[model samples]
Target: MSQTNPMPNSNETPTPMAMMQMISSRWVSQPLYVAAELGMNEAFMGKLVDLEMPVIAGGRERTETEYRPLLGAAGFELTNIVPTQTPLSVIESVPV
Candidate 1:
C-alpha cells in the first residue's frame, strides 16, 4: 500500500483564504523566540590583553569606562572601579 500526503502539492497555488491566513499569522514570533533564547545584548570579546603583557602577543587593555557598557551587555551592571597604589585597578560588578 502507498501512503498519501495530507498537505496540498507544492506546485499548486494556495487559495485566497489560505493566502490571507498566512498574511494574518504572527510571523514576528519566530524571530522574537530566537532573540529571546539567544540574548540580543550578548557580548563577545577576544584578542584583547593588558598593556603590561608583551606587545608580541598583540593586544591592548581597555579602560574602566570602556568596560561598563560591555559588562551591561553581558547582563551585569558595573558598580565601581577602585584604583590601588599599583598600576592595576579593581572592577566591581553585579548581575542586573
Candidate 2:
C-alpha cells in the first residue's frame, strides 16, 4: 500500500533573498504611486533635464567633496555635479 501526503515539499519554501525582494519591490512602488497621484509625473513631462538634489540622510550634511568619491565608486561621473548657493549642496543634471 502507498500513502499520500497533503503537505507541499520543503523545496517549495521561499528563500530569504526571494522574500526580501518581494518586500522591497512593494516598498519601492508605493512611493512611485504617490508621486504619480500628486501630479509629479505630469510636472516632469517633456523636461529634457532634471535636477537631483542631495538628500540629508540621518540628519547629517555631506559635502560635495565627501560625496564625490562615494558617487564615483558607485559608477557615477563626478564631473556632472553642479554647485548650488547652499554650502555642501550639489545638484546633478539627469537627462530624462
| Pairs that collide, model 2 | none
Model 2, 1-96: lDDT tens digits are: 342332236467655444334334443232211111234353464231223232223234466687666555433444555544323234452111
- For candidate 1, the lDDT comes to 0.47
Number of backbone collisions per candidate: 0, 0
Cα deviation of 2 in candidate 1 (Å)?
50
Best by lDDT: 1
Return the clash pairs for model 1, or none.
none
**Candidate 1 local lDDT, 1-96, one digit each (tens):** 342332358787766445423333422122111111222222221222243334412244677777888677655577877775444456766555
User: How close is every model to the real structure, measured as TM-score?
Assistant: 0.38, 0.29
lDDT of each: 0.47, 0.39
